[model samples]
Structure formats: C-alpha cells, structure tokens
Target: MQDRDDAITPGWVADLAEIGELVSGAYGHYVERMEMLPGPMRTDYAVPLAAGQIEVLRADGRIAGLLVLVPEPEHMLLDNVAVAPWAQGRGFGRRLMDHAEARARAAGYDRITLYTHVTMVENIEIYLRRGYVETHRAEVNGLHRVYMAKRLG
Candidate 1:
C-alpha cells in the first residue's frame, strides 16, 4: 500500500480510471435499493487525486482497493474506501481501513471521520466493528448519510 501526497502525475492520472471502476463495482449493487447511482459511483477521482488525498492498495501488483482521506484541522476525513468487487472477501477493506487509521496517527491526528449511505448496512456494521461510533445522520445531496468517527489513541 502507498499513499500519494504529491500533485497529480502520470501515475496518478493512470490510476484514475481504475479507481472509478473499483468504486463503481463496489457500490453498484445499491442502485436498486437507492433508486439511483450511489455517491461514490458518481465521483470524479481526478479532483481528489489532484489534491493528493487518494491512496491505492495493491494486491499482486494490481489495484485491489482505494481510499480517499482528507486531513482536517481537527480530524482526518476518511472520505471514501472501496474494495474491488472481486477482492471483497479477502480482507482488503480491512487492510485499507487499517491503513487509514495508521495514516491519521502518523499525521498526528487523534480522530478519523467518515460517512456512508444509510442503506449501506454492511459498511456501517464494519465501521462499528472497527470501533467507530455513529456521530449522526443527515440527508446530504439527496442521500441519507450516516456519519461516524473513531478516536485514535
């Protein structure tokens, strides 16, 4: 796993498409439940990639997962985390999440924040297992979002 904090470069550009595909594949199943494309599916990876807020997790030298983490003044925002559909059962999501917390710790942050669609129960459950507490819920951009936070010791 590597976290890229430099301005967008050729390598980052090349990873954009793959990141999009990974996010789409991971969240596409919720289209029926949500009656529209999920937020992650509609995201343009370039914005975060250019801002150096994206990180990629590779398995066997191929992109298996990606994380979008933004450092806030008080907390690290784990904006997104997606595991390739094919890699779902292999613990890549957990690894990426572990990486997120590690990054936050390395950056001197004591907390990490994230949100997921309300309908994404599996994701909420996973976050709960990782010691994240529900902060609140709100409708943002037409999506019901469940916000969560983890205090990093």
Candidate 2:
C-alpha cells in the first residue's frame, strides 16, 4: 500500500482529462451498455479549492486520483472520484476518501453524500465498507444509480 504520509499535490484539469480518457477506455463496455451520453466522461462542475472543494490528487509525484467536492447546505457532495488505471486495486482510493472526509469534517460539514451507478457494485461495496449507507436510488442512463451518505460529524 502507498503511504498516506506521502505528499499529494494538486492535479490540473488537463491531467484530469487524460485520466478520464483512461478510465473511459477501461470502463467503456459498461458505459456503452448503460447508454451514457457521448460527451466528456468527467465533467468539471465545481470551482477548484472552493469551500472545502478539491479536484485532484498526486501521490508520490504521480497522478493517483481525482476528487471533487461540492459544498451543500447540510453536507458536501462527493461529486467525482476516480483512481488512475495504474493505481487501481491499491489503497489510493480509500486514502482519497479519507482525505475528503477529514477535510469535510474540518470545514464543519456533518455529512458526505455521493451517487454511483448500481452496476458499479465494486464501488458500492467500497463505499459501504468505508461507512457510507444507501440513502436513495434512481434510474439514470438506463442504469440504477444508488445515492449514498456518510456522516462525518
């Protein structure tokens, strides 16, 4: 496992684009089967470093993952999260989640919420193991999206 103490730096939007391509290619079958829209795989929606928001992670001098937080009235939304193809199966994703939770708590936020396609069972299990609980569900892009929440307080 990569050490969490290792330095994690900000990743640029350009890097995120590249990461998105890699992720899309790796998960293209699911994306196509689910009939996702043809456009940018990763959408940049939040301002960088705003209100406990961040969008990048570079671990040990390498692009490790992407994390975007959108501040909300009651909690922060974990809008986007992706681990690099080379870094998958490691603890990097968990480290990113831990970092996000710590930041949200320090920002006085009481909860963290996110939604992911139900077909992404591995992701659901990961979040569940990390203390997230399913809060709702809906069908989007021909796939079931399960919304989850984790209290940070």
Candidate 3:
C-alpha cells in the first residue's frame, strides 16, 4: 500500500507515460478479445494536463499510478486512470478511486462518473465493487461502452 498524503510532483510524467502505454496495451488486448478495433489510446489528452495530474508514488519516490479528474458542473468525471504494469496487483487502482471519492466529497460534488468499454469486464467489476453503477450503455466506435456513476455523499 502507498501513503495517500504524499505530495504529487511534476517529475512523474515519464512514469505516467509508461503507465499509459501499459493501459493502452491492456485495452488493446481487451478489444481484440472482444473482436473490436484496437484504437490507439489518447496519450495526447494526457500531455497538457501533466502539471495538474495526480499521482501516487512509492515510499522510495517511484511513481506507482495516476488518476486524472476532469471537473464538470454536475460531477467530477474520472477521465483517465492508469497503474504501472509492475504495480497492477497491488490495489493501486482502488486507492486512486478512494482518493477520487474523497476529493469529490470534499468538493461537495454529488456524483462521480466514468465510462469504459463493455468488454472490459474486469474494470467494470472493479467499479461496481467500489459502489459505481451502470447508468447507460451505448455503441460507440463499433464497441459497446458503459457509463457508470456513483453518488458521493
């Protein structure tokens, strides 16, 4: 487990990029397993926001993972989340979700939302375990995508 109170710094960009690549590869695998197009992950979307992104670092100062929040009027959307391949089974994703929920509660937001491909059953299960429920499902880019929401009180 990682300490949540540590300050996030800008130097974690390279680690974040590596994590993004891992995520993209994982997503591509999921898509292929479901017979969908293996579209490229939008790494560019992550670049400009590097300074404002949140990261979790190990005790030795290695970046463990990152979660990007896109603030909105009604709620905070989990725009992106990635954990390094080496750190995948260590509950880092859950930790990031916990941190995001806390931030949403502190900001007085009523809900948190995110979207993931329907074929990504593992990811969907993780969200469900964390109290998110599917709010909608739609076909996008030839794949079924699910939108989920969790109330933050």
Best by TM-score: 1
Each candidate's number of clashing pairs is 0, 0, 0
lDDT of 2 by residue, 1-153 (tens): 332434454545445455566456545656765567422264543345333355556665566676777778999888767777776778778878888888789879999999888777887998999999999998865557899999876
Q: What TM-score, over all chains together, does every model reach?
A: 0.91, 0.76, 0.76
lDDT of 3 by residue, 1-153 (tens): 334334433334455565556557445666557775533364464563564655444423555666777678999888666666666777777777888888778878989998887777888998998899999998877657889999987
After superposition of all CA atoms, the RMSD between model 3 and the true structure is: 3.9
Per-residue lDDT over 1-153 for candidate 1, one digit per residue giving the tens place of the 0 to 100 score: 344432122227778888888888889999999998898888888998899998887765567788899999999999998888887788778888888999999999999999999999999999999999999999988999999999999
Ranking by TM-score: 1, 2, 3
TM-score of model 1 relative to the true fold? 0.91
Worst 10 residues of 2 by lDDT: 37-46
RMSD of 2: 4.4
